[model samples]
Target: MSRPFLKMNGLGNDFVVVEARSAPFRPSEAEARAIADRASGVGCDQIIGIEPSDRADAFMRIWNADGGEVSACGNATRCVGWLLLEASGRPSAAIETEAGLLQVARAEDAADGAKQVTVDMGVPGLDWRDIPLAEEMDTRGVELQVGPIDDPILHTPGCVSMGNPHVVFFVPDAEAAPVREVGPMIEHHLLFPERANVGFAQIKGRDRIRLRVWERGAGLTKACGTGACAALVAAARRGLTDRKATVEMDGGELVIEWRESDGHVLMTGPVAVEFTGTLKDRAA
Candidate 1:
């Protein structure tokens, strides 16, 4: 069958969103992996499917290029928000993912012709147990030894859980951080029991930060919405930045606010339409 999809990107974190709300089909691990193959398939960092929901407005299922299912995907969630609003003619939306329910919206005069999407990423988890670390330690500055890299700049990490695990290392320069070399090590570190998306962040000012990320299972991505949100939370926990700040990534930027009143984190970014296509002879 020919399945219709929406090719979208939040910053440069690309995704292929399939509208499966009607028929309710779950794409298998093999199929998801095949569709995300850059050389042989549609090529995307992730594949998202919209299905019926029992608890929230709609259900969102995410799969990485490696065919592994993940709990949360911030970039793809914004893309799904845009698609749902366009279909329902609504400005506000609430969608469900493997992690939890999230609120989404279109910022006024947002970039990309008002295609900018703001997601209420909910509250961030600060406790080491919440981040699910192997042992109880200060999550605000967890010690991480990345083999023989032997750089004090990369040893300590501020861990936070935005439904998913993340380790944020505050560095002097976002560009100079060895994200390509040390990211994979920290991602699979023993401390992070469940593994994690690693982020290198530099606080440019009281309300600005620059970031780069190595996403779990997906390797290095152009951008990571959850990583950005986690970075903001980590910085706030370390008292390095204000609760509200703008996180700049290689692909683009996101306005992040960790509300003092409710402790919820709000991430605002743009989701762009790339193109759409179909897949045939695929499993049901």
Candidate 2:
């Protein structure tokens, strides 16, 4: 039987959302990869399953394009949050994920029919073990590099965990960074046993930063919510940028704020519906 699904995106990071509240939708790794295939299937960076949650409004399950299940996805949370709010006609909604529970609410919609969203990503993890580095080290700038022994192409990245691990490398220019070449290298670096999302961040001003990310399992993406949050935190910790900044990515931009009061990261952006369809044998 075919199951219904929705195609959604925040900035340019896309997802295929399946409703599995009543009936579970657990796909095998191969099945997930097939569904995320650009040519043959509904292409998306990740697949999200909205399951029933006793603790929150819904339980969000995330799987990258490579079919690996992960704990968090900030962009997907906004998309799911919009759906829940529309369904319940409520001012706010809470969604649960492997990473933790996220509180979401509508920000402000635009005249162009775009839905604005705000996601309370909770507190970021800064400790060595919080990011789960391979060994003990200061998270402000981990000792790792790529290139020559004396001069490296990239070095001393600030680590942060917005549910998933991310390492932000402050660069002179974001566009000049070899994202495709260096991203995989940093992601698979021995220092990160579970792998990591690699970010190339260029601080444009005290409140603006340009960033590009090579997401683990998903490779290079237009936008990464957690990566953006991590970038802001990393920048703030390094005194490069303020606690709040506009994180510009290839797809678009997001307002990321490291709230000083609660230390929770808030991601504000727009969510869009590309289309919707049915996947054959929806695992219902």
lDDT of 2 at 90: 97
User: Which residue pairs show collisions in model 1?
Assistant: none
Candidate 2 wrongly placed segments (more than 4 Å): 111-113, 282-284
**Candidate 1 per-residue C-alpha lDDT over 1-284 given as tens digits, one digit per residue, 9 for 90 to 100:** 77888788988999988888797657789988888888988899998889988876689989888888998999998888888888788888999987889999877656456468889999888888888899999988987755467555566789999989999988899888888898888888888888999999999998999999999988888899999999998898889999999999989889999999999889888888999787756834
- TM-score of every prediction relative to native: 0.95, 0.98
Candidate number of the best lDDT: 2
Q: Whose TM-score is greatest here?
A: 2
| lDDT for predicted candidate 1 compared with the true structure | 0.87
lDDT of 2 by residue, 184-234 (tens): 988998999889999999999999999999999999999999999999999
Error of 1 at 129 (Å): 1.9
The count of residue-pair clashes in candidate 2 stands at 0
